[model samples]
Target: MNQFVRIQYVFIVALFAVVVAVSGCRSSTKTYSPEDVVHYDESYDASDKKKIVRDLVDPLVQDTFPLARQTEKPILVVYGISNRTSEHISTDGITDDIRMELLKSGKYSFVNETQRANIEKELNYQYSGNVDPSTRLQKAKQLGAEYMLTGTLRSIEKKQPRQVRLQKKTLKYYSLNIELTNIETSLIEWADKVEIVRESSKPFIGW
Candidate 1:
């Protein structure tokens, strides 16, 4: 081949090799353990859950309000927190962390209502006579929940109007309202909420 033609061919071949190499390169990923305090974005995350748990459960237990009329630890079933946001956020973490904090305070006992079916199955199996009679659990002897802990997670988002700036900003307001209701009286014994406001800016063209 002519010198110029050979040079052009080599340049095209080198460009193709570079693109193929880039395309074949593996993408990188980072993993954070549960103990890691990492904030990848301004959206709701583990840090927010931790803050909510800390701010939420601490005050409830510290107050003078009687969580239970009796002297024993109140039996509480967490019905779950309803998510009233446009975003598909998982509120399970919020519920779990709050329950954990409440338990740590030694102020309440929790009943896992989510495992009703599994518990029913186990109880039925134990009563079916296949297991030892001494180990069999008594029927209809499960402790009833004296109080229900339920809440709702609400969020409102506002974006800045179109402007000349290269970065666009978004404002998010989040509120978590938690309530303790007496099962017999159908009254809210104690209620409180925690609010968070977050502002984030990102390039308009990309994240």
Candidate 2:
């Protein structure tokens, strides 16, 4: 009986050791803040978005643009920023940042085009007499935006030729051009461009 008990204890100890080894071998993840500029490959990163916003917003609010010419805050509708690049990028992030910056400047007011359908639904409900007449919103009284803010993002990528180089190099150029256009006149009142160039390299041989 003593010999049998010693064998059981040895088996349990070995199993526990195996479990510990497997757990130690499992991969671990590191967390990063959203504001940190981390680059794992040759792609658009947080730094690019930050720089683009910085470069573009200042120009739009400068004296050369319509900011100085107009005293009243302009109502704006952000149509969208079209993505012409090959990669899958959420272009809304770019436009949203720009919109936030403009809002902070207190020179522009925005119409929420994305929520127009829901907005209409609420208005229709209110008009159906379910709510008090004094508290209900009127139909067809919504303010029209005077100008539209939109633009395009484009990228050009170049790679090293198929030579026997020790490392492969890729160069990417990105450009973002934004414009504020008058809805009535169809003329561009303000425009600015942000350009970024990035290069990345990878070793040819595998370890």
Candidate 3:
């Protein structure tokens, strides 16, 4: 009788251990699908843009400045940037980045758009209904801008789908097109294009 009781107790303990082990194994299984994971590295670096612009624009501006030394200081103004891409990109961010780089080079002085607008408003107000031709001419001369900077951003995307593996890979290409124009002559003094590309792949585990 004693031996039978001991054997029964051992059998029950072994069954309980097996049940707990199986439960733990099931809980340890990963739940997230591979497609839920995002894996793309950003192409733009804070320092890289500044370095690229400075390296490309500074020498050109320095070489060009001697020709316009007669002016108190050649003021360059940003006209605007056109987005030729499908993505909703902020042109101001890129222009501002380039502006900061050029300003740091100290080869050219830029007129802020806000300041230009204010000056324009003040000039129009003071000259309104005034018949004095000299005053109008002076105001025009005071507001003259020497150079203009404009640019565009373009993008291209490509995708490859692997039906057998249920996976997709995507590639994105970005281009920044910039040009410096002489406002007086309507001539482009400098033009440069910077290109950046990024690629990513994701696997779909679930149907």
Candidate 4:
């Protein structure tokens, strides 16, 4: 009986040891770093558009906000971007990129028009309960935007296909037009455009 009990204890100890060893082996650490570069292809992906906006559009917009170096940081509102392209591109994503770049430059303050409804809902919810009366937000106290940013994304495509050779070539040109308008004065403070052209060749198989 003693020998049987000793054997059971040994087996349980061995199993626990194995479990600990496996758990230790499974533990790992991962490191993260900033991306060094990005490549653009024919596919209509967000990365390519973001790169274009970052590299080209950002600089043009920076030039427009030269007055940022002055004493005050201007307040601006993004009216959202329009997608007039054949491809189902992410116009809202592009608008976010533009807003991010502009904000990162420390040149302007932004009033998020897109989130206004959500903000109103939250304020209403807070007013219902769980919010301190003294610290509660007031809708009438909201800051007005001094300037508005608006834009459109457009694309032009040219395609040529040779049935005999089973070869096809396509050229796609994308253009982004943006404007900064003074809200009170109803004047365009700045405007510019950035364009990108992509060409691709592929074969039509078994047609």
lDDT leader: 2
In the order shown, the candidates' Cα RMSDs to the true structure are: 5.2, 8.8, 11.4, 14.9
Candidate 3 error regions (>4 Å): 1-73, 119-143
- Model 4 spans > 4 angstroms off: 1-41, 60-64, 161-163
| Model 1: worst 10 consecutive residues (lDDT sum) | 62-71
Each prediction's total of clashing residue pairs, residues at least 3 apart in sequence or on different chains, is: 0, 0, 0, 0
* Candidate 1 to truth, TM: 0.80
lDDT of 3: 0.68
lDDT per residue as tens, model 4, 103-202 = 8877778998988999999999879978998898876778899999899888899887545666678888888888889999999978878787888777
Local distance difference test, each candidate = 0.85, 0.87, 0.68, 0.77
Q: Write one digit per residue (lDDT tens) for candidate 1, span 121-201.
A: 999899887999998888887789988989999999999999899888988898999998999999998898999888888
lDDT of prediction 2: 0.87
lDDT of 3 at 14: 95
Q: How close is candidate 4 to the true structure, as a TM-score?
A: 0.73
Q: Each model's TM-score, in the order given?
A: 0.80, 0.80, 0.59, 0.73
Residue 157 CA error for candidate 2 (Å)? Answer: 0.5
Which has the higher TM-score value, candidate number 1 or candidate number 3?
Answer: 1
Model 3: per-residue Cα lDDT over 58-123, one tens digit each: 555565556334345567888767888777666776678677776776666788885778888777
Q: For model 2, where is the 10-residue window of minimal lDDT?
A: 60-69
Better of 1 and 4 by TM-score: 1
TM-score ranking, best first: 2, 1, 4, 3
Candidate number of the best TM-score: 2
